[model samples]
Target: MKKKLLLVLSILLNSYLLSAQIFTVNNIQYNVISTNEVEIITYLGSDTNIEIPNTAESNNITYQVVKIKNGAFYQKGLTSASIPSSIVTIESGAFSSNQLTSVFISNGVLTIGSDAFSNNSLTSISLPNSITFIGDSAFANNVITNIDIPDNVISLGKYAFVSNLLETVVLGANLENIGESAFNNNSISEIVIPNKVTTIKKNAFSSNSIENITIGSGVTNIEEGAFLYNPVVNVTSLSTTPANLPLSAFDNNFNISLTIPENTSEVYANAGWVDFGSVNGETLELETFIIDEIEYSIINLGLRHVEIENYYGSSIDLVLPSEVVHEGSTYKITEIGDLVFKNKNLSSVILPNNLTRIGYDSFSHNNLLTITIPDNVYTIDSYAFKDNQLISVNLSSKVNYIGNEAFSENVLTNVLIPNDVKIIGNAAFYDNSIRTLTIGSSVQKIGSYAFHSNKITNVTIPDNVITISNLAFYGNKIKNLIIGNGLKTIGVSAFNNNLLRTVIIPENVKSIEYFAFDNNPVSEVFCKSSKPFLYNDLFANKNNIDLTIPADSYYAYNDSYWIGFKSITDGTDLIDTTINQIPGLLLISNHGTISNNLQEYVSLKIYNTKGQQVLNNNLNGIYIVVANDSLGNMVVKKMYVQ
Candidate 1:
């Protein structure tokens, strides 16, 4: 009985050994995990292109190949590999030390062990979304240029993807940790860490060309030398609490600007975060955050409003987000900070709807061809859109201020200053190709060189303008000019170098400085001022100009400057009876009959209160009539239209 029991035990042990023994099928080695399941152990075939079979025939039974064992294809001269969908695991050194340039990982793969595909020449690799774990040195020593980690990946092992040629890296949203030297020695310029990653091991991103980095909110600890030998310029941290980082983490690169959450500068400073370059809250006077690559600052906490601070992206056409959410609070973007998008080479940009102000040099030095200022924008600061390629600009109706050189050096063909603007800054529209310009009715001052070097043909200084600074409209092709009634001072060379043939100075003019109207071929001058305060060489060809003054005002023009004109005329018969009129200008009856005593006028135009020309001259409202004569003489009068 004892011998028979011993024989049964020996036979059972032999049967178990046969079922689990290593076997070969089609020059491929395999080990049986069960009666119906097997794992690939080694490849004995001498082929450069490898296709591992999903099933193996052993002992007249078929078994499914589900995993690649350790060192299965190590040191094999493989050029390409096609992994089967049934493969769930690839153990350590499965395909290491090969010359693989192409690899197709199937969707069923869940894990890649240490050095699985290391020491290869792969230029690119597509990681399947099914992968959850990547062991140490899995894909190191490759030539890949870019990488998009699978969203399902949770663990990235040490030395993974090291010594590659990566330019851009997009971390997976669910990744929990970054191992030591994970992405060392790459060419990555920009990287956005997902919110789930909490740990960054030592030398994780060392020796990379990273310029901009955005750390997620979940990151708590960064090991020493994690970012060693990197020239990082801009860093955005979403973590409200400062992360623990050694001074050697960035390897003496303490000049990187840091942007953090609102009102957290004190904590960051205590944590040595201020030891780096300027902190946004402390230096920039505002707490900043980044959303979708655009940096924004919290301007008003109670109102939840933000201002765009900077843009760290490489897109030619950009559309700014209207609002952003940070730390469970929503903030409406209402302004653009100084130098936000300067020199970005942008072709087009769409401003946010709620944006109310544009800061200095906001969009300067770009390739923008057209821009439409939003209706809510109230201010455009100095050099806001200077040195661009703009062909057309639509000013906001609510704009109240335009700074110096705001639209300078552009190719603008037409510009309409909205009615609310009060002042035009010096050189505001200088060096532009403007052909038509409309000064708003509320403008009180025109700064020096405001409209210089434009192709403007006509100019009508509205009734509210009080001062025209030096060189205000110089170097323009202006043929007709009508001064407004409330003008007090005309600065030096204000209208010099224009193609003016006729000039009409209003009654309220107090002073006309030297060269105020120089370099103009003025054949007719109509001045309604009864007592001209002071004057200099105001006109280039004053000896050939015909001066027309009020009928009883000839006594005031007896001075040497006024007598320099070729002729002075004062005829009382040209005056209107019902109105305090200038001689030889116009006569308007209560029934809106506009007739001038002089028959030299060739063309007549009528404009309403909003500066729009009307066809019918017979209307019962206060209107402005502009008449031009054959001799290039012009008369502008306010009359009743019926």
Candidate 2:
């Protein structure tokens, strides 16, 4: 405990100031990446069990251990180790040649460096979905029986899993490059490569236990000797043309049947398909058709629904069929594939009711003016409608997520975020012209830059919102804001550059970050916190603003930050709170009486032929009611006779 607790002090000493220093806990040294932020750099303990904490404390400073640096845990002897979610990278040879039978890598890790876990004794390992790259020889010579790469991963580096005892390997959906000899000596029997992969480098799977393989439609190249040695019996390629490959790609693989998509057998026959034993074509429930000179591929989602695969159109108003017929199958379009309209000159498009999911960047950089998202859509992936000239969008009420930059840089003037959304991703509404936004009661968090640089004038944040992240409403001309009570935190610069005159903060707030309301001409702040909360330069006072707090909690905001206000008080009443709004006009009440608007009359002045005060609140019948509002707008009305 001495080693661990003392390091906490080291973190707090400089972490907050963006300062850093190395520290040791339990003889394991950590390099301070920031204050209370660290990366495991050396393992000095002689223990057999290793547990890396998500948080490390030294001197009251809580450090997030975010990385395991290169060669940090390269030494052997320990049999088990666990890395926490705070970690992001496992550097080259970080845990090479370990005797561990178990290692848990959390989803926060983005890269497993070259030879990071080679020659490990682990029988099973789970790489979380956050992984993007498995570097050269990363997990080679391991005894793991199976592996499932996450869909976000892009590259499997050269010899990544060479000589492993892997019998099952599921390639991720987004993987683009299988580097040279990535799985050169694995025992994988068969593999279905996802369609997104673009290249299988030379000798990528040479000398494997593979007997069959299915190459998806997206692959464009098969380098020499990609399948040099295993006794491959059947090969299925969905590409309409033969992948760019050398004659030696399958030179040694004899007695193999090469199967191509229907109508593609002749295309591959002339491009080294004969190197295999035979070539044949199979119709696998997928077809390409020309719609307005654009090539489209469709596949059945069910007996009735279909999904659009690709769009190779140049410039047109694409009208996807509500129902398309292919191979005697009547299919209702249900989804639009990722990047379906990316970088295209699609002027307009219509979606069918059966459509549900709009994939990432589906309509990004398009010239669409208005589009109707059908009711059934539940997910609007990141960048789905980004950078469009869309002035109108009819979003489905059922959409649960407005992804990062979903409608950013659009011409939308207003948006009513539906009730089902739980999270508003970062920069979700950046640079939009939305003057009015209605957040449904179900929204919990407004992410950073979610509404920055908007023209919103007034808003009432629903009571359900708990967090408003950094720069959420910065650069807005917000004049009237009614903050909710459920809020816990206001991130740095959350509402900077607004035109607020006064704000009554909720009582449940606990934290306020740096410059949360800076760059504004705020006149007053009514704080309700009984216990003082952490504060920063929240005020850029252009005029005197009364810092009002509860009488019993005067000391709560009696700090340096609060002292910077023009004046401080605990008074709630007698403060100007009305705005000069458009007059609703005088109307006779249903009760045959008129309610008076005396918001401006702090007190009454009377005159009876000689400037004499007369009959204030003591009048009986028909005395004239005269008063000015908080904005000094004078009014006169005849009172009712009781």
Candidate 3:
């Protein structure tokens, strides 16, 4: 009838171009998408353990590979990837620059596009609740450490999981927005942020190592440098209308301890959000009142103070009441709010001599062996008494700030940092079995990894320490370090891996960075700087140490970092012949033999004027020898050991 309808429309346009053709079977490359589906498109397989198949026969017609197209396995040297509930959409730069450490992602993954799995070495990731949209830079620069974002994740695009060694993120409660620089530069120490997120974009969580942020009352547009360079000490914000941020969001952390919603703290202290620090609101109309059955709360009904907040009596040896009259109103408890006795298997509680604040994470993960920190506490906020089973604490000689990880992972065999502690935050007493640490002459900054991994054997940095930050006393068994004439910066790896053999660098030490005495076996340094002390690879064993400069300073230690010191001497006639032979060099004997002609005496402690430690040749009454010299020079004589 018209040439049989033009030959049946030319056989239905050649069966729709042979079902959108582009084929290849085992080494993957698919694209058919019709006669029974198929999408993958690239990966001419050199197999670094890939397994992404789910059906692909090609010309014999099998298909059903679903979608994975754009730049399919871009730069694939993928170490391990299984991804196959017929992968629903994984497009842009598919497995970007891979050396992927491990990825399973199977439940019909719905969308994970731009730079998908970017530059990988992924430590751990399993996001497939049929993932809803996670595009830009998908798992960027990954050594992923942890991630959970999949509760049907709704959009997370820009730089999605940027630079990841992310220590735990759980976002995605139908996440909504949160894009630019997505979880930027991770090591995210605690972040909650999920209540249908609502825009947190720019530099999303910038340079994180975020120490506790919680923010989610449907967030509401946080954006600029999102949580810039975080070290955010305890935030909380369930948004009782405080969102509009931008004082550069949270860079320069402003000493945080926020927590809101309840009387809203004067609308979050008039919206600058209390300019960052102590907010603490959360009162559901206050009036709690419970005494020995614990609860408390009243918060300042005109100075009748009160605040234990919650503990329904099951005493693992508890005892609190500094004042709790209640209906007839006496109150005066003073505060111990956040997570009141957390995980309270409290093996000794007793703290309320009108406790003046001990809030966030009050007695964290407890089984407290002994605490006693009540001198009207003056704030001991972050993880106050952290992960306890603490073998004796008693700190708070009116504690003037001792927050981040306050007494972290403890076994504390003695840690007295209380001369009204001025700032000893980050990892404050971290991983401790601290064998006698006492650093408090009003400690002025000793934060990062402060007393990290301790079993301290002499580290006297207290002359009002002016910053000894990064890795402060790193992995210590510090055999005498003593750098504090108000030390001015000695940060990166400060006293790293120590068993330090004599290092007294203090004439207001201006910057000693890098691996500050890295893995120390440092044999004698004693630099009381007459200037030139801006070091870097500080001293693993700079050609076997022995530095000692401060005479005419030997033209500031003849350069090249004290000429890689294995002898730079000139210590002003060895410090005026060791301070004029320390007034009769302690020669005691008569069987209590103490003798010290002082040839750089390393450690001789006799002690007994009731400071109890006698045995330097079995010393008796009024002793106190205390020698210590490989030039950190301290010869405290006073002997009468007869």
Candidate 4:
């Protein structure tokens, strides 16, 4: 009995020494113990056949087996590896550098670390459905011919399962993400990405010799150069209606044919793979239009194609066909499209009298110094002559309507807006160098920004005008504004930043748009009628000036915003009463004002030498004294003190 007990104690002591010794199994750290002749360490170095111990006691210690790590028998000398169901986590770097003919991971293993079983000589690997995460570099550079990732794995890390001799990679339905370069440089003839994968990183299967690719429907933004320079035979994105397939996403590939889905609307410019290629052996169509006996085509977005005939004159300076007459009338042939002659260096163009509407962007961006619009043309399209370096334009009075942005950014010094024009769109003359603008008496409406950002010093808005669009005269250097007697509404931001000294609001005008004259340097607004001129914070800064209102309208003006004003009945009396009445009026022009005391009524009329009333007003107060004989020119008048 004493000998047996001593022998048991000796065995225990030997197990302790063996367990304390650390050994590196294929570069993996492990502590083994040997007891009672039981092997504590197992070196499965590139072995093909690996069997988990069943009741194999080591060091007399009962070990709890948890997992059979990946590469546990990678490239091992053994021919087969049958993993037991007791494994849970296949730690990274485990089972590597082993020569294994076959690897069978049991279903009980839940996690597989990276690089496990990589560079293996195994003919096949059927991962069980128990794997949740295939770690980085797992099974990379392997000899696996085909792989179907189990539905249980959720993610695959970078280089995991890459560089394998895989002919087909069937990602499982449970896959959520494919790591970068996971399947790069692999012989994947075809791959059907799982719909569960939300992202496929860069170079993931980039250099793979894939003849077919099936992208899942879950992907939205295909990362830049994701599949660039690949030898993909047939790449089909699952998205039937690709929202934003970039221009260079799949460019530079060796694909035989591509079929754009039915729901796609726009195809990018360079998306056709090469610089110029026939779409199904047919050239892409573009918008084409004709003008002046010449066919113009706008190809590929902005390139203009023009084909000319030889029947026209080739004088080099002026080109006009010999037979300009087409119909019985003097009008010649006519056809014009948008931007027909835009950006051209043509020296001159002669339009026949039969010509009508000028097309949109017809003469835009041209360097022509002078242009003559024929009297037969009644319409001018938008941007017809915009941004042109023209010095003068002979606009025929026959032009009835002008479209939006017709003549913006031009160099015209003076402009005569025809009375036939009914509508003028926004920015029609914006940023132009026009000095004087004369609105014809027949004009009705003025569109937004008609004369904005121009160098106009004087403007005479016709009384028949109804609506003045926003910012009509904004950023102009105009010092004088003649508001017509029938003007009604003033649009927002109009007359902002002007250097006007005084402005007379006609009685017929109703609404004054917000910020119309907010920042104008005008000192006073002259009211010729009894009506009150509405004011808000827009006129808060100009509250100190004295507002001259008619005697009857003084109460209305005072109640609104005119805190300071001179109440007068007759227009002539104010000029004769004292010189103080003409405060800001003379600041612009020193023209002496005239008064008529004989006119007892509120109306005062000043006639010129032709006996015609050149100026008519009703306000009567201490007016600037001046003598007006037969002519309306100012004559010397006796000055009066207060």
Top candidate by lDDT = 1
Off by over 4 Å in 2: 1-304, 559-561, 571-642
**What is candidate 2's lDDT per residue for 265-351, written digit by digit as tens?**
567756656444456733243455655554444543333545566786565687777667656667777667678789888899988
TM-score of 2: 0.46
Model 1 global lDDT (CA atoms, 0 to 1): 0.81
By TM-score, who's the top model here? Answer: 1
Q: What CA RMSD would you report for each candidate?
A: 34.8, 23.4, 24.9, 35.0
- List the candidate 3 regions with Cα displacement exceeding 4 Å: 1-30, 33-93, 96-115, 118-137, 140-154, 157-319, 329-349, 352-357, 360-369, 372-380, 383-390, 393-405, 408-425, 430-453, 456-473, 477-642
Per-residue CA lDDT of model 1 for 294-411, tens digit only, reads 9988865656888887899999899988889999998998889789899999999999889888877999999999998999987787799999999999999989778789999999
Comparing 1 and 3 by lDDT, which wins? 1
lDDT of each: 0.81, 0.72, 0.72, 0.59
lDDT of 4: 0.59
Q: In angstroms, give how far residue 586 of model 3 lies from its true place.
A: 74
- Cα deviation at 578, candidate 2, in Å, is 29
Rank the models by lDDT, top first. 1, 2, 3, 4
lDDT tens digits, residues 383-456, model 4? 98888776777778877667678888878888887776645666887887888888877665677898898888
Worst 10 residues of 1 by lDDT: 573-582
State the lDDT at 469 in candidate 2: 82
